[model samples]
Target: MSDFSATGYQPVSVSDPEVAALVGQDLPEDAFREIRDILFTVKGFDLDSYKDRCIKRRIAARIRQLGFPHISGYVACLAAEPTEQLALLEALTIHVSQFFRNPTTFMVLEKKILPALLRTRPAGRELRLWSAGCAMGEEPYSLALLCDELCNSPEQITIYATDISNDILKKARQGRYEPHRVAEVPDSVLKRYFTLEEGFYRLNDRLRKRVRFFHNDILNDRPFHRVDLILCRNMLIYFSPPQQEHILKTFAAALVAGGYLVLGRSETMISETRELFECVNAAERIYRKKADDVKEDD
Candidate 1:
């Protein structure tokens, strides 16, 4: 498995051989299935779509955190506590975000993507952008800052940010962040867009009003339509190949012809969806949706 250290997930070691065996063996298959089924039944979270080992590690981490001896105990806890189910969902859906998390990608968006989209936008039509899996609103807020700079008028742009976690969405709506979260924000831009209050940098009302936050599951919910650009960064790496492909196809259908799609620095268009989009910036993982006349891979 790839190192999840970046997300603060550390491999746990225990002295108890049985507990160690549970972690080492990725938990018994039946126990893991029970956990998955419980999450699906209670929260509508489809654990089957996630990478198996990654989900296992998260579950094991939770088990270790709660001081559970084994997987069965954790399963019982999940069944009994509603809060624990939300906690497990939060654990499973790891969200690590900051303003302009990847500088180059944002630079590309500000300098190249936004300009091109503005020039090509049809008269009387709003420029629509979606930030899928927008954790705590940084990605979409970052886009809003750029759009605020480039667009002729505020009405020209419409930004929609969505995440599966309602709790995270509530935080996003609050539009407040700690100092570390806004570290990447440029000094001048920070002064203009945010107010430092009580040690928290709060995004100003004008910019806050620019974005619409929704509780959405990309796998199961309807995607935004007629979008000029979609930024789904760092979130796709959690899913299985088939789920990833399903999401890519959904993005393809969501975007208008010649629309742009920006993925994470680590993610790429899978083989099945490659023909749906032409690579625009390989280093930045930016792609453009192919026009309807273009032929798709069989």
Candidate 2:
């Protein structure tokens, strides 16, 4: 029902009643499930964990991009071309993200959460952070700059940034952004952390080296444990309810006592995950892991 034009490439829509009828009437919902399941089983990527409405929109985008008439045509293309699987994965996970995407949330994190974590940890100790679904490296890079100011050395603060799409991860690793991408960053901070080119900005090696990028599927992969903070902002809204609950539990397992977890301002903890964390700044969607709970892997 949904389509994928938002990826920046407008696909030419195709109309074929025969193909539409086949994809709709003959294959039915079972066909969709099979295609989704095979993506994980054969290719080791799980697309089915996402909400169906989101899945359908992405599939529609792929269909249009490849000039397929309907699901049947798209399925045929996938069956023939292995590379299409990667394309489909990118389409599904593609989201709009930017540096300091939400200023108030980052402000809350800087003013409240970071200070509390620093005070609790022992002096001269290393700090760990995870940036889930760290699209194009902006979120983790933003965190790295903040940590650089607080910690003794850039090496002391390790930011593990993970995303499901390798294509996006590659872009993130490059640490290069067009002018529009850096528009929100203050000019002074920009001069300190990034080198501005004719039209693109390149994040300095000091900031980039601190963030270790990984091609991780958060839905199925094990998250890094014993992290002092996990920034999973804006990613959960795309997943279904059960998936969200599972991720929150995994985040809980990964955090140390009194660790902080940050989400998008629009996102909040589900009723099921409320016990694991207490809201530190509800207005900014920041939560701290309960000090008393034992760490258990999900």
Candidate 3:
């Protein structure tokens, strides 16, 4: 008998009794204090403000998978182990994303938001868009498709896609996807927008050139320039409240007057900071910056 409970169970080696017993334990007080300092030295982001329980579960998952004896050993491994550092980042970073992720949101943008913007775009000026924290390329690519549809010449629109993970950015830049991933794109649009290549569809160069991919930490990097719209979805859910507030303020500053902001369906602007934005589509999580704001925080 394996002595394992199947309904709520895992293998002994992968879930060693001692390690399972340690699940509820906090990272050693000193180790918790040191983690951010160490991670910042290597990864350039502070982890201290992340909710302890969230951090604990992620670290515990890693420890369990690797059969580490203690959080201290994991901390030491993070310092001395490059592979472990990458694994830690995988655990901490948000990777979940999809194309035309929420159909109604895209529907609203196409039906109302973009048409309104096109009506107002200054003559001879390009429409600029930024997809901050763009993951695996889906969201930004979807935006690119929208721009291509709306533009007189797709070349006139510029989309900047930025993410903290180099690995994910590389995948995004490739713009190749399994057929199932393109299911949301209507057949007509999919054929016109992408080309079949080696069992996958690749975003054509016209669309690819419209998007410029960059490795950027939204909290640390300079804001994208001449931004008419910014799409920063889902990525902020893991951030501390203060970080969220700072990012919203930063986004408000970055946006050109009347420029739109799109957040994940689950997110909302901090009401106390209402002076910076006016919700344009409350149900859709879209907002427009006040006319008075243009320059970003230094």
For candidate 1, write residues 18-57 as lDDT tens digits.
Answer: 4775667456667778988898787766777665456776
Runs of candidate 1 with Cα error greater than 4 angstroms are 1-30, 37-57, 61-70, 76-85, 293-298
Sort the predicted structures by TM-score, highest score first. Answer: 1, 2, 3
TM-score, candidate 1, is: 0.82
Residue range with the least summed lDDT across 10 consecutive positions in model 2:
5-14
Alpha carbon lDDT of residue 231, candidate 3? Answer: 92
Question: lDDT, candidate 3, residue 154?
Answer: 68
lDDT of 2 by residue, 29-52 (tens): 665676777676556555654544
lDDT of each: 0.86, 0.78, 0.78
Question: What TM-score do all the candidates reach, one by one?
Answer: 0.82, 0.82, 0.81
Which 10 residues in a row give candidate 3 its minimum summed lDDT?
Answer: 1-10
**TM-score for candidate 3:** 0.81
Which candidate do you rate higher for TM-score, 1 or 3?
Answer: 1
lDDT of 3 at 179: 83
**Cα error, candidate 2, residue 30 (Å):** 7.7
Give the CA lDDT, 0 to 100, for residue 29 in model 1: 67
